[model samples]
Target: MDAGLTPVRVVGAGPVGAVCALALAQQGVPVCVLEAQPETARGDSRTLALAQGSRLILERLGVWSRLADVTPITRIHISQRGALGVTRLDAGDLNVPALGYVLSYAELAAALKQALRDADVAVEYGIAVARIGASAAAAELATADGRTLATPLAVVADGGRGDDAPQPRFERDYDQMAVVCDVQTELPHAGQAFERFTPDGPAALLPKGDRYALVWTAARADAERIAALPDTAFLTALQAHFGGRRGRFLEAGPRKTFPLKLTWTGSEAGNRVVRIGNAAQTLHPVAGQGFNIGLRDAWELAALAGDTPADALGGAAMLAAYARGRRADVVGGLGFTDFLVRTFSNDLGPLRHARGLGLLALEAFPPAKRFVARRMMFGANG
Candidate 1:
């Protein structure tokens, strides 16, 4: 079979899947996207923190300019509550225009959808896959509507939440939940973000348009209590937990909570069937590595596909190569997030002191700080 004549079937039309499809289409690889949700599905209100590297990828795909209300992160302040050590990362020091950008997930999804249409990529909405399997010849998919399809390659980016999703080879329950909402602070953000590590968990505030998007991590029970608090009480609890760094949290939007965990499918999967984004691995949202890693996964896969000969698009060798190339970034991201969650989300006296010293050491060393900052902006390679 001529691989060029067989379009790649991308499952899930979310940001990660859309990126992979757009990149593939731009590389002249025939591609089509299948989204289970209808075109009129409600927009996602979740906010996203995109690193500069992701910005470059979207720019290359010609979708960056289409986004709206994106707020740049000029600086990030990281510290441990009730500790003596603190460290800050400045975009100016790093010589980057901005470390990252914050925007609603819906905005990014809309831009990618529009870009797909402009690139002439075929997208089938409201088509839920009943099963996705792989064979030496091709990747096969069965839809709920009794339709069957086969392609040289199939990309899964549905976040592994579907009934047919693959079971994760590795999983860890953190027993923590994050209370998230948009908050108005007494003081202006001015593009400054905060990562305050507490004994319970890490609390993060990303600068959004004229406000901040808060992800306050705590024990499951505590998070539920916080999320259920009335608006005024919620703001007061937030101020108490996060401190006066941004002054009192004046107002808060609707609060939501999600459990935190680390799940990975490993590098190896079915032949010619690749998983990207949350479909492959979902990590704790401590350092915001999971989503960016997913973007890198999509970008690199598309690049490698473009380089490989059409006849070997999803051959065993190609899959092996893809796995090898992504190992470092994937493992690095997983390890980094896991380490932060375990190491900092505690209150052992000795460990707390050690963490404080570590922060102080990192702050004193310019090169080390830059290295970590770049890794956050890029990946392990950076």
Candidate 2:
């Protein structure tokens, strides 16, 4: 396979795109990666919660050992504010070393980039895809600099930000904002993550190094107010809301806020262009499903492409199979996260009582709990 005439072209050099390209290249498939941003500007400060399955994928890609500042989550605690509902998920139940991991987005990106370089994959940074379309023979792409290229398959993993990317077939605006920061609790995290559902939204505290990565969800107005508070005031507010589960929050890092939404580009893989990762679906961050599902999308696509002959890389049959294969996992993840956001983020009396009972039941049933845990750690197929 010629490097210049790669059969597959992947857009976006983010975690998903990098993983897809690296996985394919490692499997003896020639792949070229186009990144809209320059290498120096690709650092992302956001924290990512990667499932155990995702760790396996990275380990297969040979970048897992290169990641720095990673914190493993051995258990997860689920509860509802002002309710009797409480459930805990432990990695020991499944005999896994950890349920998930927390690391900076930039660290993962760095590791993947290093692996790609070592694999001799061609990655052209700052080469934006201005337009992309597919034909029976190949997928055509128009670059921002007026250069045109074609490949047997074009994978759009740029989080649906490309110009020619299809409009989201399903769109939602949750009218909530997630205020994200790192906070230090008086007591150690002990490798436990917490998800506390409140009337505003769901707040997550994932153990990250010496501090906990905090995702405080709230209504738009409330989130704005919280984001603008001084460090001391913010810590006080977080302490009041998150309760004493982790003891008092002593120190805080800079905070940022992002609006919540669910966006999906449908499951129809049109022509030779297949959208995966965030380009395929973007879910609410309730259960940390979005990024991990994107990783699975990348890995599965790479595996399917590797098995298929080069001449039939982006054929209708192959694309269709990819879509069908991913439908269950993608839809299940979307539904699970959306359900949590809708069902638990409110304080309605009837639903609150029902949710409490449901949590109690889930805790009491080992098999059912294990099923859900595996689903989160892997996917619907797991």
Candidate 3:
């Protein structure tokens, strides 16, 4: 088969998969994306915080300008709930235009969908993947609609699967659910994102225009109870937990809940298959790094595919190279998010004091603050 005519088959139409398809198509690589749902299907309404690095990737892919209107995060604040001190990070401090931007998941999907259409990438919505098989020559994907796609490379961005594959797996269950929603507060957020770690879990308030996006990671029971609260009751509960940081919470929007866990899939070299995004790893939402890291995977893999020789596109050597390129980032991000969730989620006296002191030190010391800021804005590599 002619290399230029051969397309890459991507499973899933979530943000990660769509992003991979878009990046590859932009590089003149043909792509076929299979989505299990219709194009009009409503996506999860949660909000995502896009780090500076993620913003750069979207800008390179030509989708950031269209999303500029809805992206509102520019600063971040970190502290324990009811703590006397808070550490703040500003985009200006790092000499960047913005630390990060907050985007609604649905809006981002819409933007990427439009970009994919404009690029003329092939997308088959409402088609489920029945099975996947691969060999030395090409990978094959069978869909529920009776369509078989043969491609040089098969990238699974659909998320982690139970069946066996080439990659090693590492997982951790937090037994927590992240309850997310929007809140209207009496005081302006001033575009500052706040993260407070309590014994229950980590709660974050990210600024979005006049309102704030609230992500509270709590025990399953607590998450359920909180999700069931009436708007007035929810506000009272939120104020009690969040304290007076953003003043009193006035009203809240609909709430949603999702389980929290950490997962990582090893790289497969000789199977003519590669997994990116959620298929590769899933992180705790405390640091807001899950989707951002997946975006990096998409951009990096696309770059690798664009540069590799036609005969080597899905070859063992090429796949291994890609894996090597992504290993540091994948491991580092997973470790960081894991540590943040475990370290902050505890109320042990000694650990609490140590964490509080650490925060104070980070605020008092510019070097330490800058280092943390750099890691947050960039990745481990940066």
For 36-124, candidate 3 gives per-residue lDDT tens digits of: 88989877787989888998898898898878546556678888864445687777777887777888888888899889898888898
- Clashing pairs in model 3? none
- When 2 and 3 are scored with lDDT, the better candidate is 2
TM-score of 2: 0.98
Candidate number that wins on TM-score, 1 or 3: 1
Q: Using Cα atoms with residue i matched to residue i, what is each candidate's TM-score against the true structure?
A: 0.98, 0.98, 0.95
Per-candidate count of clashing residue pairs (backbone under 3 Å): 0, 0, 0
N/CA/C clash count, model 1: 0
The whole-model lDDT of each prediction reads 0.90, 0.90, 0.84
lDDT, candidate 2, 1-382, per-residue tens: 4745556999998999999999898778889999999877757679999999999999998899998789999999999999997999999888999999999998888888889889888889988999987778888889999988989998888888876667788888899999999999999999999999998999999999999999999998899899889999999999899999988999999999988899889545648988888888988888999999999999999999999988888889899999999999998998898888999988899999999999999999989899989999999988
> RMSD per prediction, one decimal?
1.5, 1.2, 1.9
> How well does model 3 score by local distance difference test?
0.84
- Candidate 1: residue 18 lDDT (0-100): 95
For model 1, the stretches where C-alpha displacement exceeds 4 angstroms are 1-4, 267-270
